[model samples]
Target: KKLSRFGVRSKDYYLYLFFKRAHKSFTLLFGCLLPLFFNAICSVITFGLLFLEKQFRLLDILFQIIIGQ
Candidate 1:
């Protein structure tokens, strides 16, 4: 009876269907990859800063503000 009141789905109807079908696989993949991606970024930044000089220039400051650094 209530189904007849709203005779339309939504734009995200397919998304809801996908979640119903493949929720486990998607969550498992994300769980496995998230930590690896974060660690890779952290290691890269640490490695560069470890070997680089510690001097800061006016240009560096300016570029940092401009580029949201």
Candidate 2:
């Protein structure tokens, strides 16, 4: 496990460990991938939220609508 260097009780290990404990069918050979996946997912979600805020701002000007005022 590439993530063997990481603390087993931390976020990545706990998530995978729970999966194993529950006898889940799927497993990632490299537990380190969980942190990478979590970060990537968070980034995408944050970007989407930021983009929506900007889009609403543009809509506000176009439609003469005020938001969060």
Candidate No. with top lDDT? 2
TM-scores of the models, in the given order? 0.45, 0.50
lDDT measured at residue 24 in model 1 versus the true structure, 0 to 100: 82
lDDT string, candidate 1, 1-69, tens digits:
556544445436767787866888788888899999999999998977765534346667778999997
Error of 1 at 19 (Å): 3.8
Which residue pairs clash within candidate 2?
A: none
1-69: candidate 2 lDDT, tens digit per residue: 656656655877789788787664334434667889899999999999999999988988877754444
Best-fitting candidate, scored by TM-score: 2
lDDT of 1: 0.74
In angstroms, give how far residue 27 of model 1 lies from its true place: 0.8
Model 1: CA > 4 A from native: 1-18, 54-69
lDDT: worst 10-residue window of model 1: 2-11
After superposition, the stretches of candidate 2 with alpha carbons farther than 4 Å from their true spots are 1-28, 65-69
Q: What is the TM-score (0 to 1) of candidate 2?
A: 0.50
